[model samples]
Target: MASLNVYSALVVLFFTRAAAMATKENDQIIKDNNCETKMGLPCVLEAFTSIFKTGTISSKCCGELVGFGKVCHTTLVKRTLENPLFKDLSPARIIVKSIQTWNICLALIDSPSPSA
Candidate 1:
């Protein structure tokens, strides 16, 4: 029983350290890529809502998000999922939504605009 408890504790400690290290690495990536400054606050909020809830992203915001780059977008989403406020959310579902949002934004940015 004591050995089992020790094993469980060790497993918990290992995961905690790993999660911390991942978060630190993600923060560095965000900083190096200037992820925070890439998009305006309103667009960022729109992207967040589009991924975290049932919402749509505007063409302008989609352009901002596409310009934000996939690496930065993915890192930001992963970091946001680490927040306690989103604890109840399903990571898998959120990730799928994030990918969907990125794809939609990418398509929007790549598509040609109508001529006047």
Candidate 2:
């Protein structure tokens, strides 16, 4: 579990390609799009950190990691745009590309790619 977390971050830093780059700039042109409404990713992370007890996976975390839970691979990339910290993030291409890239990277390492 410990190893997975670090690898996950590294995967985020590695992916340089993603299909989402095509129209990512003009994709979701929502003017007042707010993220608080979709803060599920952070909530999922906090939930894991709270349940990650020591080197062993807590039953709580395991339950969330297994079936019915999507946190095992999915990271909060879409939530970044709403985050005030990364709101002004430039090169929307890189941000959007990284999100899709990490998602695929995580899918490859955590599970099979979407039957590509």
Off by over 4 Å in 2: 1-75, 103-116
lDDT per residue, candidate 2, 34-110, as tens digits? 32233355444643343222123333333433332233223334434434565565536545454443443335456
Candidate 2 vs. true structure, TM-score? 0.24
lDDT agreement with native, every candidate: 0.96, 0.41
TM-score of 1: 0.97
Highest-scoring model, TM-score:
1
User: What does candidate 2 score in Cα RMSD to the true structure?
Assistant: 16.8
Number of residue pairs clashing in candidate 2, backbone atoms closer than 3 angstroms, sequence gap of 3 or more or interchain: 0
Q: Which residue segments of model 1 deviate by more than 4 Å?
A: none
